[model samples]
Target chain A: MTGVETLIAERSASATAVIPDIAHYLLNAGGKRIRPLITVAAARLCGYEGQGHLALAAAVEFIHTATLLHDDVVDDSALRRGKAPANQVWGNAQSVLVGDFLFARAFMLMVDAGSMRALHVLSRAAAVIAEGEVRQLAAARQIATTRDQYMDIIAAKTAALFAAAAQVSPILAGASPRVEAGLEIYGRELGLAFQLVDDALDYGGVAEALGKNTGDDFREGKITLPVALAMEAGGEAERSFWARTMGEGVQGPEDFDEAVARLKRHGALDATLEQARAHAARAVEALDAAPDNVWSQSLAALAEFVVERAY
Target chain B: MTGVETLIAERSASATAVIPDIAHYLLNAGGKRIRPLITVAAARLCGYEGQGHLALAAAVEFIHTATLLHDDVVDDSALRRGKAPANQVWGNAQSVLVGDFLFARAFMLMVDAGSMRALHVLSRAAAVIAEGEVRQLAAARQIATTRDQYMDIIAAKTAALFAAAAQVSPILAGASPRVEAGLEIYGRELGLAFQLVDDALDYGGVAEALGKNTGDDFREGKITLPVALAMEAGGEAERSFWARTMGEGVQGPEDFDEAVARLKRHGALDATLEQARAHAARAVEALDAAPDNVWSQSLAALAEFVVERAY
Candidate 1:
């Protein structure tokens, strides 16, 4: 098992049986344990040898999973990670209520960790995560979403948790301010790279390979990074195609294929990939101020691997 | 303006703008401002002369609005209080994020309330509320939902907030223990009564009078107190009716009317109303120990008004 996997495994039974069942269902469904892994890994890098990191790490995963569950319901998504979503199996009501349960359970677990700093990190992250979702909703299909707006959305929605996880671990480990800031930057950049790659994959991913439904974002009228860039670069032809395809009503499979082809023709995918790589490099750059350790090196490698991973 | 409206009338610009939007959306949408009023009235009974109750009262309203936003999205509810819901207007993504934002902003506001006691009451209530929602999810359409189980659900989902609203006022005002306990019980019983009335109203209320879609509970297949009692009273015929109706897609509108008629015949509404009245009485009973002030007398009258007005 991976280090993060072992940590999740060890602490999986801490909450009520019902909570663990949903948590296991979500975690085992597999979309990468990147954020919590960063938490544990960063703590290890800071020369911390305590097991409290395990609970805090699991708390981070629970928070992320809760957001995902709620997000899927909001998006009316039918598929995720190549499987029927929790809402599909259990219904939206269960999915949402369980998401709430997971959120509460995570905080309860953090309280057990007995660190005010941990609570602050997790609570503030919760607020930012919510703000990011709102930002994305407000930006949806507006065609006015600039690169800065996109960055802000990703920072709130995706990167905030990752940043909290990395920065928080050092705080838990009692590291100096300089080291904490470095870890925070590393996590934030990594999260940006991860989300950009996700946007790229959404436009171009093979469903079988990526374990997620391709083209659903376009169908739902979501204006992701690639689409945003394409809209910026596209001439009248591309612009009209976007307006018609994402406007409303039933979107045929052909429309999806055409949108994907348009994205490729505009070189939006390559540009998005370049952006992802830049964020990944920036993540590594942030790690430079940290003391050398195996966990630090692993986190840097993980940042690189996030962009490289097919799914 | 209602008493609560008068309270909201006096606030800062930003808070006034945002809060009234939520309050008007809710109060005009017509949720009995039972929770917040109980909060303000409780503070008054405890001899709290300051106007800080207005913010606390608004805090209670915000929490209630946030939950409704999440609940409607979870239920995919198209209608609420005889109108299109916030989710219907803004979409589920916006509703969910706004719900979260409300929750975060609530805590930020509470922090300014500056009493650790208030924080404990509200935070613990938040956790309990989440747990209650989960319990309701688990019990949905289940045949084995016991009355005790129902009580637990109501306590968490409804009473927890009411209890916090009432109890926190006393805590914030630095009331004695006996006074705090008295107000807590009053809120608890009142919440129980309020929820029972809601369950009954789902079957018994006039669409125009309640500003609610009639038979919503039945349509949603929720396992409310009335349905649970009726199910227990039901023979084989009624049991099968419940199985097909609650939580499942309806066969047609006529089928829905028939199911509601069956519920009425079974005296489910009466049983629930009687239970509600009993709780209202119990709530007033708890207030006997409170000092004979205008606030205390108003709260006593409010308890009686809950069961009576909800009917």
Candidate 2:
């Protein structure tokens, strides 16, 4: 099993029994487990061997799970990973509170890592995660969302933890500042690539294949990269379509299809894919500072794999 | 002005502002500003004269506000302090994200405080707050909720922060361990009293008088101290009433009135009040260890005031 799978198997029982039933429901349902992979791989590449990385890996997973629970509630999403969301199965109140629990549990795991540096990095990331969510909420589907604004949102909500995962492992492993920065850059780029592709997939990928409800961003009226690019590229027809579909709640599934078509027609999805590729390249470039070894190669390979996934 | 009042005045602004109005919204919205008061009051009593207290105070408030936003979204609460809740006014998505922003901003304020000790205290409290929230959700309407279970919940959610606020100030002031422990105990007692009275007020106070929907806990089937005590004392009649009302969310205004009458008749409400009084006494006793001074007196007065308010 992968480090993430191993960590999940170890802690899936007993330690979090209060939330176990719901956690089992969600964890078994499906997810990429990409965040935890990033954490473990980063640690391995940084030459960490004290087993503290296992706790940190679990912490990353917990934080990601917490965000998903809150996200489902915030978006009022009924479905996730081709299954009923935790909020849908249990209720918003339970999902939200449970999400809080995971966040707390994650922090506890970090504390167990026994480094003030780890605490500082993770805490800052936690705060940034919240800020990013807020900024995204404020931006919503505004047609005026600048690239800078988009960068800020993604940096906080998506990349911050990934960067921390990469940087912290090296820091704990007693890597030099230069090595830490390289890993930080690698994780951040990988995160950016992952998020960009996610945005694109929401606009273009098959729902069943992706294991999630596609065109969800459009349904939520979220001004993601593809939609922004499509609006910039498309004529008045596309803009009107975007305007109608990008409201707080979905009007219907029909609108989603129409919006997706508009995105494809404008080459917005392709552009987003290219953006992901660019970040993936940057991520690979970041690992050059690390000494050449099997672990570094694996880390480099993982970044490519993140971008290579079709769904 | 009082230290807390001055802090509030310095930060206060109207919540009504456009997106560009970050600074304004950051400052205002008429929070009781209780956390800062606790922090500042503790600092002063501990003989802290440094400016570090100001940032810590703001950090605590930010954390509280962030949780409030998340709580409103989680509860689907429409109103807060007689105004439309963040979720209601800005939508759940906005509220959720903005709540995250506040959480992150709180960390920034703490980082500004520049004390690793302060950060450790606050970050741990943040995690505990989330844990308490989860515990409350898990324990909701659990008729068998033990006193220990309830204490665990409050300690994580409420007393943790109180302890952080009180103890952190003394630590920053370089006070002795005895002084820190004294302040921590004081804050704990105060928080317990405050939460207990809050439970009482939900059932005993009027909606107009409290400026919040009265008996919300009952309607939501939240097993608070009064409810727990009532459950323990209740005969078959009360048990049936609880069975029909709790978790069913079927309690109307008349049902609320009937529930209060049951509590009063069973002497649960009185018992709870006595408990609150005991806690208040403990809170005051905690101040005895501090140097006899105006700040210590204000803290004692504040402890009394916390239980006195119906709202």
Best candidate (score: lDDT): 1
Show the colliding residue pairs in model 1. A81-A211, A82-A211, B221-B246, B221-B247
iRMSD computed for candidate 2: 4.2
- Residue-level lDDT of model 2, residues A4-115, one tens digit each, is 5666655544333456676667777778777777677777777778877777878778778878888888776546888888888887766776676566556657656666
Question: What tens-digit string does per-residue lDDT give for candidate 1 at A99-172?
Answer: 76666556656655656666667767877787788767666666656788888889888999999989888888
Candidate 2, CAPRI quality class derived from DockQ: acceptable
Error of 1 at A205 (Å): 3.9
The DockQ values of the predictions, listed in order, are 0.28, 0.35
Tens-place lDDT per residue, model 2, B112-228, is 566767776776787778767767777776666777787778777788887788877987899988888898899888888878887788888666655567767887777888777
DockQ for candidate 1, please give it.
0.28
Cα displacement (angstroms), candidate 2, residue A227, comes to 3.5
